[model samples]
Target chain A: MSTTTTAPVDIFTEKIERGENIEPRDPMPEEYRRHLIRQISQHAHSEVIGMQPEGNWITRAPSLRSKMILLAKIQDEGGHGLYLYSAAETLGISREEMIEQLQTGKARYSSVFNYPALTWADIGAIGWLVDGAAIVNQVMLQRTSYGPYARAMVRICKEESFHQRQGYEIMAKMAAGTPEQHEMAQDALNRWWAPALMMFGPSDKDSLHSKQAFLWKIKRESNDALRQKFIDKTVQQAEVIGLKIPDPDLRFNEETGHYDTGPLNWDEFHRVINGDGPCNRQRVEHHVRVHEEGRWVREAAQKVLSFEF
Target chain B: MTKTDALFHYCLRLGDDAVILGHRLAELCSRGPFLEEDLALTNIALDYTGRAELFFQYAAELEGKGHSADDLVYRRPERRYYNHLLCERPNVDFGHTIVRQFLFSVYDRYLLEELGAAKDTRLAEIAVKALKETRYHLSHAADWMVRLGRGTEESHRRVQQALNDLWTYTGELFEMDDVDLLLLEHGIAADLHTLRALWQAEVKQTLDRAGLQRPADGYMQTGSRKGIHSEHLGHLLAEMQYLVRTYPQAAW
Candidate 1:
């Protein structure tokens, strides 16, 4: 009933400010929509690219039980990716375009995945540290303003905790086992510690999108705050399992009741984000190769779908 | 062969097939043509891995040698593995994978149905549970068979090529040795010979719908029952057993 078309932006802003859920059909600022699309698609891409490192170990999982667990976990990651892609589709972007963006390096996934899963213990480290960091961020996103994204986060967090537990179990078992296994556990923690910290992304002070995303309720917590929470929870877990935190300067600050750590390697984080990490090229290349190889199959599926209609 | 020995071999064959094929499918995890297909392949992989564990556990118990399922899966040498050669065929492409899966699942579906009613209650129970899963596996692979065969000209060509290449391996699935003859006599195993005709009919029906040609039966591959395999199995086992073999005393 408003005479002016400009009133919808005011209404959308009011709805966001009031912490109302933004349904797919709800009026929203274009910037808010774009931000959600970008954020959600990147999250989805991380879920997918995250599979490669863990998938690397499925064949040599040391035991039948371990192999099955790893395969199921990776399957869940793929399912999460599917759910996230569907949620992003509600924002009006096709999965094809998003994939194109990923392959072309226009979009980014978690830089943590750009590192290789070098050994079997690396799998445990990934599930524990990487997924643990992700849970902290996703738990906050479950309260995000977008209804579909929030719902997807809710389901994903349940499985992520399971993945985290399995990973921690692996770490614990190895940490308590033979000397070689203990070494393997410690080495994995060493390699993964910094990268896992980087998973929360750049500090909020330097993050270009953090301010707008926070104002829109697309992101509820700062990267540094989430990183601190992950560290606080994970340090005790590592201690209980007998694995050392890789940080030399990490200490418990009695004043703040928080574990404070040395400065993160933002240089390496930026390097990985900019496509210079060990597995960045390999990851994207493999994805592109698989996509290209399946072109005929996807076309066949489309053709069959058409025939059915 | 005694009935117990025959049953152990039967379970080993079933377990080996599941684990080997599951390994091939797991290798396709992130390599699927798309995300949905990726998840589908891995889901099937997980199912096969689970089924493999059940079969191996039963086999280990029957062996009564203080062996665990992990020992049967990770400690066995290549020549000792009794999986059908078909299951160990490399996943060369999506067409190859689907064709291989479709071919094997048809035979597996028929085998499990008969095994589900076998006189051996434990094998029957496992088979009944597995039959439910095989039903889905067969349908999924069969659906893709039609899509790929009736899809693009390239897809049709690729899939036909895959079928032609893999046709020789199918004969091994129906081969019966002393183990099968003994188990069949006790009504503890499904008669592979009897299941062959039903498997053929079901496969032919799917192939017809997909417009795929039934490849000519030439020199059908054999020797898996005799512990002989193509070169692929050794490499597959080497990678699969490396971790457990490397640290024999270490607990995972």
Candidate 2:
């Protein structure tokens, strides 16, 4: 309470140790701001890039109901990206800078989106598994130390739950339908399962930023722990829907009360992160292309704004 | 046509217009000029999709044939679709998309305003609900029309090009035949011919504000009344109807 005697860095560390939130104007280490900017912007980029695959199927959504739902869901993802970009902006990075970093391959998004949403079932699988995985990590982030990011996470988590359910609903319907539909669902699950797992990032020991992140309370859970939690919950949901988890190595351990999975292909994960995945170039290219194409529109809007002012 | 038959066809035409235009907007989901614009486009697409569902459901009810809304949306072949040609035009760019949306939304706003007072309560109710959304859509599109028209030289040029290309299709929106005449007599549909003047004035005002010229009207496209469409509708349907057509018995 004696702020006159305390250093700002000590107060920052003390606040972190005492599990207090960090506001935008609060005195904090430069490293912490950098960490949140990188993480949050990457998360924002993921949301924007994530739209492409799901957007792929909006026109082909089988039912009018499904089309509306899918369109709304993609809109939600776009909205989430906006919120996140604003959140990151609080830390001093411009939206333009973050987007430039992404386009230039200096920043990274979740590698899972690099995969194509190949079938209608892929739409379901993405909603169910991909969003499901994202929710587990994001739910933990709701308690993270950063006030703005945590608040954004809280709102995002709410919509993400709906997204996950809609996805699973698609998977469930397909799993229970005709053989072709069932095959589509299963195939989608098989392809998406590992990539979804990769969404949690590397294992605790191997994760580059886990140590500092945990010490700062920016991250509330280890990547492995969060991934495990997602796996345990999702496996049963898949079982009830009569679809199998593609992981042959998956098993529930009564002792730990956790479902264990096969070793993730870290090489593939790294490869995708390094821009070798099937859709990596396509995603970034599309983003750059869209941004370039919209230059005139953005310029026009900017000119109009100036004129009005 | 009987009153009920006229009502069913009326519903289909309305539903088809919504679905096709919604489909075109949906194609721009992640491809908008920017993130905010992207979300706005999809939101409009969603509104149209929802309206299409309501219209299709009503059509299904009137037909008394147990066809679900999905069936009406997915099972119909391209030639069977009665949407105006404008609805199925490709979204060539942001300029084109905005121009197309502006043109349709102006017409839609006037049509919905009249339909909201229809003697047929169901159609009126649907129109009333839809009018709320259309007003927002029209304003959003109109704002962009002005901005793009007056914004920068490049934007003005691009949008003007889009306007000229899209002008012909606007004629088909007012191409009323038996369905409109019959439904008009029954108080189930708005008078398209009358709606056209209001639509034209509103459009001209926006164009004037945006500093753009209305294309000289020429050879207006037709045939949506007979389920005929541009080459675009067939391709749009093939992509849209693929899943349902591939698995006819499968429920989504």
Candidate 3:
């Protein structure tokens, strides 16, 4: 019989109350470790897969200024994935193993990225709401118990703030411009709003990892809580830009003192999460092909590492 | 053309230089000799495109036509473009691409640094912001130059040949015109005279490190800035402007 005696629930609850970090080396519930791995790895995969859409626009960016900003942003996404994978590795997963999971589709990334960036406004939307939602969750993750992830989150949050501002700037210009530009901006927002909301993952009730993940201090807040926060913050930002918040029910509730928003299209969210979104196949197939094509480069890098003295 | 018209053309010229060079590099997307190099080239393309966009946007503002960056990039016909000749040439080979980028980046670094101080506030602002990224890009191209220049006999020979093939186009970069004279009068652009010695020294050091020889200055091509281009630019525009031409305001 394996004699790795488990600690009671109170021990974890006490640690949270005391604001102590739960290091990876510390023995915890099997569920907690698995949940952390799943969440962190999903986050890492999002960062990696996120490169494609932005990269598509790099060649077509209307100006050199937009191109440079996009390039740095995409590179930052790569660097963000590296940090996240390293964070996940602290839990004893190898980098190669994690990458394999992504390559093989055994792991999940944010489904939002599967939506193709059809226009320049799409890029602007991604930077604004997508990144805006991401920053909120990342700010929460900065308080996560894992030391490495929190530190990485700090650096990522700083860079992501710039990304968010740049995206907002693009939309602000469009919103203030010609009627066609305004309509285009509104259409982009309408398409991306729900996806951006879904980036916080499933609702608290639907989230399998929420309760225990919270007790373990791996997740500081519930998905629904983060989503509400994002919606409330985004509405004000939208108003300032002269763009309407697509949801008719989107308003501040004086009674509950939070934003009263309409229910999400959970069916679409679930379908996308389960690999049936518009670009799910496209995104995965592209990734697989690129990974295969990049094998020679990886081999060459390995050879360089082992070059004869 | 009035003085402002000349200034507008000058801005368009710089914008076109970056846009065409960016378009050339964009052809290498996913066609790299290696993945890192692929990513790096795409990244460079992205940077150049971004710089071009800023210039065109500024040009439109200066012209006060309410012309968008897109109107300048997509609506204008070929004869209207005023980019330097060097950037419009084909990406002959890997050696040519790297050498071209290296040569341009060095000049760009000096030009942008000087332009950052131009009396024209918009040009100066754009130059200051662009200088940081160009500095890094120059270092990246220089690093590759040194490596390929010194790596193997074949590599050295290929890069040397690229340098010789490209040398004829370098002269037009410093060739002055009426717009240049007008801009100089306004302290809006640095005289290429101040940049020549520095550009030469930088190129020599890199070439020397790479075991390459400088091409003798026998017959340098000129006049692309005045819209007399080599045969290569036509095909480049055909491909680059395809979407905008066909769709004619398809936002997506």
How does chain A of every candidate compare to the true chain A by TM-score?
Answer: 0.96, 0.96, 0.91
Per-model TM-score, in order, reads 0.98, 0.97, 0.72
Q: What is the C-alpha lDDT of each candidate?
A: 0.92, 0.92, 0.79
Model 1 Cα lDDT, one tens digit per residue, B5-90: 88999999999999999999998989999888888998889889999999999999999999999899999999899889999999
TM-score of the second chain in candidate 1? 0.99
Error of 2 at B179 (Å): 1.6
The superposed Cα distance between candidate 1 and the true structure at residue B165, in angstroms, equals 0.5
Q: What C-alpha lDDT, on a 0 to 100 scale, does residue B80 get in candidate 2?
A: 83
Docking class of 1: high
In the order shown, the candidates' Cα RMSDs to the true structure are: 1.4, 1.7, 6.0
Report the number of the highest-DockQ candidate. 1
Model 3's DockQ score: 0.15
Q: What is the per-residue lDDT of model 2 for residues A1-309, given as tens digits with 9 covering 90 to 100?
A: 775788889989999988989999999999999999999999999999999999889888898888888989999999999999999999999999999999999999889999999999999999999999999989999999999999999999988778999999999999999999999999999999999999988888666678899889998788888988998899999999999988788888889988878898999999988989999999999999999999999999999886552
Kindly list the per-residue Cα lDDT of model 3 for residues A196-291, writing each as its tens digit. Answer: 998887678766557667766778888888988888778888999899888888878999888898888889988887888888888777777766
Worst 10 residues of 2 chain B by lDDT: B179-188
- Candidate 1 vs candidate 3: the DockQ winner is 1
DockQ for each model: 0.82, 0.81, 0.15
